[model samples]
Target chain A: MAETRQTELAHADSRESVTPLGPVRRSRDLRVYLVVLGGVMMLADLSFIFWVAPTDSILGDIQRVFYFHVPIAVMSFLAFFVVFVASIVYLVTRSPAWDRLAQASAEVGVVFVTLALITGVIWARPIWGVWWTWEPRLTTTLILWLIYVAYLMVRAYAANPNQGARYSAVVGIVGFVDVPIVYYSVIWWRSIHPSPVVGPLAQANALEGTMAAVLLFSFITFLILFVFLVAQRMALRETEDRLGGIKSAMRRRAESVF
Target chain B: MVLVWKDILLEVRSRELVISVLVFGLLVAVVFNFALDVTPQRVTAIAPGILWVAFAFAATMAMSRAFVREREQGGLEGLLLSPVSRDAIFLGKALTNLLFMLLVEMVLLPVFAVLFGFSAMSFTLIGTIVLATLGFSLVGTLFSAIAAQTRSREIMLPVLFFPVILPVIIGAVEASTRAIGGETTVGLGRWLPLLAVFDALFLVICPWVFSFVVEE
Candidate 1:
């Protein structure tokens, strides 16, 4: 209990230090709301995946990865879209909040993209008979991953924090623009990846009614997860900003004492 | 306009940028001869890819040096402090870089043809080169400025650049391959628009963001 109290004091102290830059007025209730909503959606998605969605006619149990895989892929794209919008806003307004949002979404997007790629590889193993192929979708996602990875690296290596934010905002905007080009370039060439299931060209009734419901549940769950993860990451960014402020303050104080 | 002319005149007087890029590009093509072990007959099939790889690398080399002259001469800050807008500086530098790259490419093309024996001098091939080079220089110049401020400026430029420009390279190679293979009009028809679109997007976006980058 004493240890817990000490930890709480440290947290409060850090939070206080962040106010010099204007406290990140993050809504605790909003975070709690997202976490609760995500938990509920996750439970519903798992239930549907196990109990409602039928086994694939061709691929059987292994094909179940699709229910989680496709939704996460969609969420990853959404996350990058957020990064693009946030980057633009940051550039226009020069607001640290938007930069924080952009950076947070990009980091979360990488995680989602990684999960999608792993699930994609697993799904490909039994079906495509290979662990990986340069399919159009796979290749585009890989490039997207690389661009954002470079974005993060630029931010990490920049000479100054402010300059890094400016540089990364530029990268974030440019990198997002490449996504559609990567997609179109690959699509124009050739693709071994499966065609869309819900588009105009999709097969009639490719998804059964129950399967559609489960997939929808998965998408909702993943969207909630995306929101929760981004908020959590944004909060961590605030804490970091606060700690940096506190460290510089302490250094200034030490110099004066000397 | 004045900035652009200044850059051009500076290059004209020194002749360093064009000469180095041209020699380096030609050397790369020659090296590809021994590296790939291409038989004369197979040159038509592989020449486009080799040419693009060489151009891409050569363009990167020239771009890494884009701001080094200004930085070395201690003129970057004076330019930034001048009444000219940041966009003008970017434009001036980009135009000069574009001219230098095209000069290198124009000379490299004949040399490449002589070396590879691949007849890569058609109208369609020229069109593809122009479009590809425009996009290359625009993106390269912007990244060159960004990388110049970093510790590992030379290395950072390529690492930050090549992946972003992969689509341009693919489009150029595919189009140039078809053009060299005698499908000139059809190949140009297919890929030229894609390259044009990429160039147009960067032409507008890079300058807008460049001011932000150079400011702080």
Candidate 2:
């Protein structure tokens, strides 16, 4: 255990030294990627949001919200699936790297989920004539939001660092399972929300050509941004771990000197 | 099975968890009476929800005691080190909790009925309560085990539990609503199957996940 600790300390120290001047060498490529990807999403959000979709009388121009809303919701679900997959991988391999990946993805999933909820409400206010309704889709989304928020809180307030990862990983796995149940329960319970768009092919064919292109482009744009966010967050987490190690080392050094 | 009996025996001797849950449940019923301003006609409609809320709240209190006592007496680690399977530990604890919750529910049912002027002796209502409580206790026990590891465990248990088990509560209350209102077929048709499904799912999943959460 002592030898392993020493090697871990040395590895972290060397990585820190190599990236001392820049914003941490580990995150450099990821940061550049995120900046570029974020720029692409912003452009897409501006262009297709107004230009692509036809407006309905009841919904007004607020149908534009679908461009940003649907993509974020889809990406959030995808991000959580990654968290679930990574959690299973971590449990099987007992690898800290997989745990970090799961944690990073969960954090990004929360961000996108929040954006989904906000944009959803924005769309609902005009379309449904209410800011919030206990409609099945809305209710399930709210529950999903609560679950992920609780996930974040569990990790934040956990007293024992080692136990935190394991406990939160289990939560990540179970929480992901709940997502599908939530989706289906809404349908099963029979609320006012519209049914899912069905198959990808049917969904694509339903949209106008330009609208389909724009929506697909926005989806790709958000996917890239999601990856970039995960990478950046993982790099920051690595830096925080290094700083924690350094603090422990400093404490040990002071104790030895005294 | 013998280990599960041992847990019941321990609880019978101590009476700490059972007494506390029973009293807490009664208090919740009393509070709901004044809060909801229950009239005779409305009582049947509201009784099912009140019963569940009281039971759920009291169960949260009871579950906090589930592992804390073991931890305080230094029994948990010793239990883990024993030859018994971990699932046995989970089963024992969960069964014990189920019994305690039922004991509380048994008392609360009559008191709530009398206070609100409703009948508690109906067979269908009894069946719905049994199914709902079983599902609640099963999931509650699992979450209690998970929360026992955390720092603010008492608060943590409910936070982790309520959202996960909301579907169970919904199914139970809906079923109980139908049963209490004398709509026997509707109660069994919709809620009973849901309750059974929830119970089955938790019983299978919780034991598999318990070992992971309980590891030090």
Best by lDDT: 1
Q: Flag clash pairs in model 2.
A: none
DockQ of candidate 1 against the true complex:
0.62
Q: In candidate 2, what are the lDDT values of residues A48-165, reduced to their tens digit?
A: 6686556534446766677788899989888888988988898778776687788899899989989999998897676656777665666777877777777777777677656777
In model 1, where do residues sit more than 4 Å from their true spots? A1-26, A191-205, B9-16
Best by DockQ: 1
Tens digits of lDDT, candidate 1, B78-173: 899899988889988888878888888888898888888877658888988989988888888988888888667777788778878988988898
DockQ of each model against the real complex? Answer: 0.62, 0.50
lDDT string for model 1 (A46-105, tens) is: 988988899888768886898888989889899999999999999999878898899999
Model 2, span B90-110: residue lDDT tens: 888888878777877888888
Top-TM-score candidate index: 1
lDDT of 2: 0.75
Task: Report, to 2 decimal places, the DockQ of model 2.
Answer: 0.50
